[model samples]
Target: MKDIEVNELKERLDNNEEFVFIDVREEYEYEDDNLGAWNIPLAQLPYKLKELESHIDEEIVIHCRTGARSGNAKQFLENKGFKKVRNVLGGIVAYRNLEEEE
Candidate 1:
């Protein structure tokens, strides 16, 4: 699976690039903080697959609190035939850290 760093993602967001950003963390975590991604927890992904059908060929980035869950989510989406799925390396924690540094 492909992996994207926090900085690159931030650049993409800043550029207003069109892509599907998914937060695979739980609802509470999402409520606490997020990068404006769609809330689709990893556990609920299978059931929500249909909702993402239109985005199968689109650029999809998945992230959680850490990289592990999003890595698994990347594999799962690939198994389900998603064409352009990527995991955010180091996930939201890394993203927040990068933002702080900036």
Candidate 2:
């Protein structure tokens, strides 16, 4: 999976570029905080693959609580032939810190 820095993702969003940001954390974790990503818990990803079919050719960024789950999700999507997939290197925690710094 490609590694994307949180700052880069933030800049993309700020520029109004459209891309799919996926949060692979649990419902509670997602509710607590997210980078405005589409919430799809990792456990349900396989069954919900169809939901993201439209994004198969687009840039898709997957992230979880820390990054492990997102890595797995990235691999899954790659295996399934999703061309452009990225895993945020440090997840929301890192993004939050970067935001504060900026």
Candidate 3:
């Protein structure tokens, strides 16, 4: 695992950079607030692998409420032969703080 700080993640979004951004938080959590990322809860990730097969070799960024879940997601994808998986450091908490700072 490689990790991306929330600030860098923010920059990527601002620039409209192309990458697979997956929100591993629950639907309810995502419904509350999110980065408009494709929602795939952490527990459901195994079942969603086929849909993500196309992005196996692409850069995949995962984030959760904090960082733990997304860190697990990063490792899970990596173990599944999906390289370039990055966990958002400090996750959405830090991301939200970035907006507060602005």
The candidate scoring highest on TM-score is 3
Candidate 1 per-residue lDDT, tens place, 1-102, comes to 468999999999999999999999999999999999999999999999899999999999999998899999999999999989999999999999999999
Q: List lDDT for all candidates, in order.
A: 0.93, 0.89, 0.94
Worst 10 contiguous positions by lDDT, candidate 3: 1-10
lDDT of 3 at 99: 94
lDDT of 3 by residue, 3-78 (tens): 9999999999999999999999999999999998999999999999999999998999999999999999999999
Task: Give the range of the ten consecutive residues with the poorest summed lDDT in model 1.
Answer: 1-10
Comparison by lDDT, 1 against 2, better one: 1
lDDT of 2 by residue, 4-42 (tens): 988998899789888888999999999898778999999
Which parts of model 1 have CA positions greater than 4 angstroms off?
A: none
TM-score-based ranking: 3, 1, 2
Q: Of models 2 and 3, which has the larger lDDT?
A: 3
Model 2 score (lDDT): 0.89
TM-score of 3: 0.97
**C-alpha root-mean-square deviation, each candidate:** 0.8, 1.1, 0.7
* Model 1, global lDDT: 0.93
**How many clashes (backbone atoms < 3 Å, residues ≥3 apart in a chain or on different chains) does model 1 have?**
0
Show the lowest summed lDDT stretch of 10 residues, model 2. Answer: 1-10
